[model samples]
Target: MPQGSSKKRERQYEHVKDSAKKRGASESRAKEIAARTVNKERARSGESKQASKTSTQDKKSASQRGGERSHSGSQGPTKDQLYAEAKKRNIEGRSSMNKQQLAKALGR
Candidate 1:
């Protein structure tokens, strides 16, 4: 969001935002995700002052770490992740549904 940032960072932010939006995230949520992602990268690269412990510890880029496990990959969303989404959607009987059932009910 800040001006005068590196081209790479700006591009990363836009990419993240667009990706989130495509994933059906709300505008604010997409922006938040993009900002968090870019900030994490900035912290990892020492471009920002604040550094998260995870960012400091992990040497791999975010993409490199999970590039192969994206939404369209064989590894679908986890049970907990689906549960969180179910909660967001206020799905009924979510507590009783298994991962597959949840995914089916959510039409994912």
Candidate 2:
């Protein structure tokens, strides 16, 4: 819900916000996630002028981008995140492991 977002981006933000809320994210956190998601998508699609360098160059989806940065803060890595890292590292048996197991295996 930041300023200067297009109508399309605003709709995307609302959808993402609701989805995050359904997944049990706090209100403010949901808003933040939604805003970031919409902004990143806008950047990827060249719909926004305020694109990040990484956002412009990265060919991956928003989910993939989020996974890469999920561990940067206090929150633990998500399953998708651990899987992505494991995939990058070419770790064996990663596909079969759950989030906790993957975290343990990755020494996170």
Candidate 3:
């Protein structure tokens, strides 16, 4: 937590950090995520002395945006993830399927 942060920000940092860890982020990564989230929030609310352009101008708060951008890579969900879903659903001929076929089979 940053120096002189309010109790609310401190609690928010811990909550975000724990949530990140639960989602399989490493300890360091979790800390970084928490710090960034809290800092951005502080900047948004004008609690900090210095703020970045994007941080202050963002339309949505960190929690409000949620993970809208998560799992949206070059082609969205990875082939492995699609395959696993296909396997669970027992899609026909899934074993011989490529990434696109798996996605199509799984109706992604």
Candidate 4:
């Protein structure tokens, strides 16, 4: 890290310490904030990963719902429908994506 950036972080830490002291924060409370601010970043990232897993599960259920609603003449969504789903989720270049590409883009 650059010297200036390191100093900036030290300043931020000092500010947090001062604020905690001024507000009569418990040691535990201060430690909790400290953990969330720095040491727990990885834990927060893990939470986002779990959220993406739930999203994948949700997509699976939604696709199944479409499957259940198909009439005799009406078929389940085709590749185009999957691409549309990708577009709805703001996937990049969804129009150009095939079914497998759409699925990968949607997951990410």
Candidate 5:
């Protein structure tokens, strides 16, 4: 956090950093994620001297987004990821199912 960040911002940063680490991010990556999230929030709330257009104008806060955009590549989550979820859910015929079918079966 930058100098003079409030207690709330400090707590939010720690929370985000710990959550990222729990989700398998490296220590540096986790800290980066936390800082970005906290900074965006600070900008949005006018707590910071400078703010970016996107940071202030985004429709959803970083905390509210809650990874909604994560793993959303050009094709979204990979076929293997879909298949693994299908297997975990005991969806029948998962082995024979194509990526699209697996996604549909899993209600993705």
Candidate 6:
């Protein structure tokens, strides 16, 4: 037989709602996470009707902005660690450099 009407699905969905209410995750939060996941999947699919070039640029700029906040509120690397990475990478003139300077130099 064909799949039954959505009545069963709706009942199961109600159970899903009850279970979520019993737990701490709210339905709104679930929907927000789901929306973000769907957007990510759509980007990966590379089949959107919009201009691919524009979306590609948008993604690049958004990721660059994210990187700017990635290292905040943390101790970050130690001086010895910096020396080691600089040495490994053969980044010259690091003896007189600071961490931000080292990062910029090594980035190149």
Score candidate 2 by lDDT. Answer: 0.85
For residues 23-75, could you state the per-residue lDDT of candidate 2 as single tens digits? Answer: 99999999999988877788788888779898788877756677775565676
Across residues 1-108, which tens digit of lDDT does each residue of candidate 6 receive?
A: 014324543454455555565677688765444444334434445533443444444544445577654675767777678778999989889999987788777773
* TM-score per model over all chains: 0.53, 0.55, 0.59, 0.27, 0.58, 0.30
Error of 5 at 36 (Å): 0.1
lDDT, each prediction: 0.87, 0.85, 0.90, 0.55, 0.92, 0.58
Model 1 scores worst on lDDT over the 10 consecutive residues at 67-76
Better of 2 and 4 by TM-score: 2
Q: Give model 6's TM-score versus the native structure.
A: 0.30
Alpha carbon deviation, residue 3, candidate 3 (Å): 1.0
Query: Tens digit of lDDT per residue, candidate 1, span 1-108?
Result: 766579989998999999999999999999999998888878777887768788777767767777643456576789999999999999999999999999998998
Scored against the true structure, residue 5 in model 4 reaches a CA lDDT of 32
> Local error of candidate 2 at 56, Å?
1.1
Off by over 4 Å in 4: 1-77
Roughly what TM-score does model 3 have, to 2 decimal places? 0.59
Q: What lDDT does candidate 1 reach at residue 90?
A: 98
lDDT (tens digit, per residue) of candidate 3 on 45-78: 9999999997999897655788665555556788
- Model 1 pairs whose backbones collide: none
Measured with C-alpha atoms, the lDDT of residue 72 in candidate 2 is 50
RMSD, one per candidate, in order:
11.2, 10.4, 5.3, 18.3, 6.0, 10.7
Q: After superposition, how far is residue 101 of candidate 2 from its true place, in Å?
A: 20
